[model samples]
Target: MLVKIEGIVIRARSFGESNQVVQVYSEHLGKLSFVARGAKKTRSRFSALTQPFTIANFLCFSSGNGLPTLNQADLVHSHQAIRQDLLRTSYGAYWLDLVDHLFEEKEPNPGLYRFLKTAFDWLEQEKDPDILTRMVECKMMAAGGYRPILHACAQCGSEERRPVTFSIYQGGFLCETCKHTDSHAIPLSDATIRILPVLVNLPIDRLGEITIKEETKQQLERVIRSFLMEHVDIRLKSWDILEQMRKVWAASDDSTST
Candidate 1:
């Protein structure tokens, strides 16, 4: 039975001679891998539709086989700008890598699909791609059950407190009383504790000209990094590359500021 699905190409890699294995995050069918026969050829039927970030409609089927086999594909969203820019591509690839590595196959995530599609569009016009990427991470975390309890202390359920520690081990804020629970809890500024919930709730597209301090961004990064390490349950090589690119971007920014 041929199944028609709309999805974004999260990954496409060489399988055998003149063939490719393509992974797509479909809104209706979740993540699925299809073998694109002869996709490697320049004039192959799937030549353009088999690459990462290409949103397309696919006619595919799994005939009791290891992977679904694609019959035909048509491009839906070109996403040409992301591919043409290096920094935008880096962050965009980071998003794709996170989805490919962290998410489970055949798990329908419509909310995530919408969020991802919108975020990718924003990446093309990303004023600060790193910050945009961080926003994406927060949204994905919320969608993936890793949302941190920033509103109140995760332990005592008390709100509006100072000197709270963000406990990655405990999965949220730790009040001074509950701080003893996790020795590894990192101290968060009152402002950071206040701002995190905002970021978690904020829409990615509306993040224009809303400048957050560098210190606050770093603080958020540390907290999110630990949260992912503790909960997401996977390490990504793309994360390391993103970090290296971030350093280079930062150094360039610093030099231009002087």
Candidate 2:
């Protein structure tokens, strides 16, 4: 049987000297794996279309009992700007890894596709990496149906000014009373909560217009890391690299301050 789908290449791996195994997170099929023949050799037709982060239209054929093989693929958007930049490359890998782990095979999810496309477009065009990361996290969280509640306390009914803590067990922000009850709860700020919705709703083209303070950006990053650690089941390589990057940055700042 032959299947056609529009998708972004999330992962690519070498199968043999002449063929490669590729996994795409598709708009129509959720996640699907394919074998692309001779993609690594020079002047391959499927080379551009099979690379990670590439968006393309693909024709695949399967025996109805085993893995599919790519018959033809046409590139729609390669997003070279994002693939070339060092900072953007790191973030792009992180984003795709998260997507790959969270989504299931052949499950149709239009919202997830939209989020990935928009996020890549933003990272390709946006000047600031901080805003891009924030926007990605907010939308990805919402699309994944794991967004932390920012409006009300997860434990208790109070909405007033109160110490906020995140309950990985409860899956959102908690009130002072809840924090007092649990020792594992992590602190969060009102500013981080306020900025989240903006990231969720705003378009990628407009992301550069919003200026965020470094402190607020760090806070948001921490909140996102904690949430992913609790919810995402798969271990991510890019996330480990990102954490090391942050640690290095923090150590440098400490030394400079001293």
Reference-based TM-score of each model: 0.90, 0.85
Q: Per-residue alpha-carbon lDDT of model 2 for 1-258, expressed as tens digits?
A: 999999999878888997889999988789889899888777989877877789999998998876789999888899888778655777888888877777667876887688678878877885676677767766776777778666667777577846477666666677777786667876767776667657767777676678778888887777677776777555788977876766776688899999
Error of 2 at 12 (Å): 1.7
Between which residue pairs do clashes occur in model 1?
Answer: none
Error of 2 at 252 (Å): 11
lDDT of 1 at 219: 92
Estimate the TM-score for candidate 1: 0.90
lDDT for residue 96 in candidate 1, whole number 0-100: 89
Off by over 4 Å in 2: 159-163, 200-206, 244-258
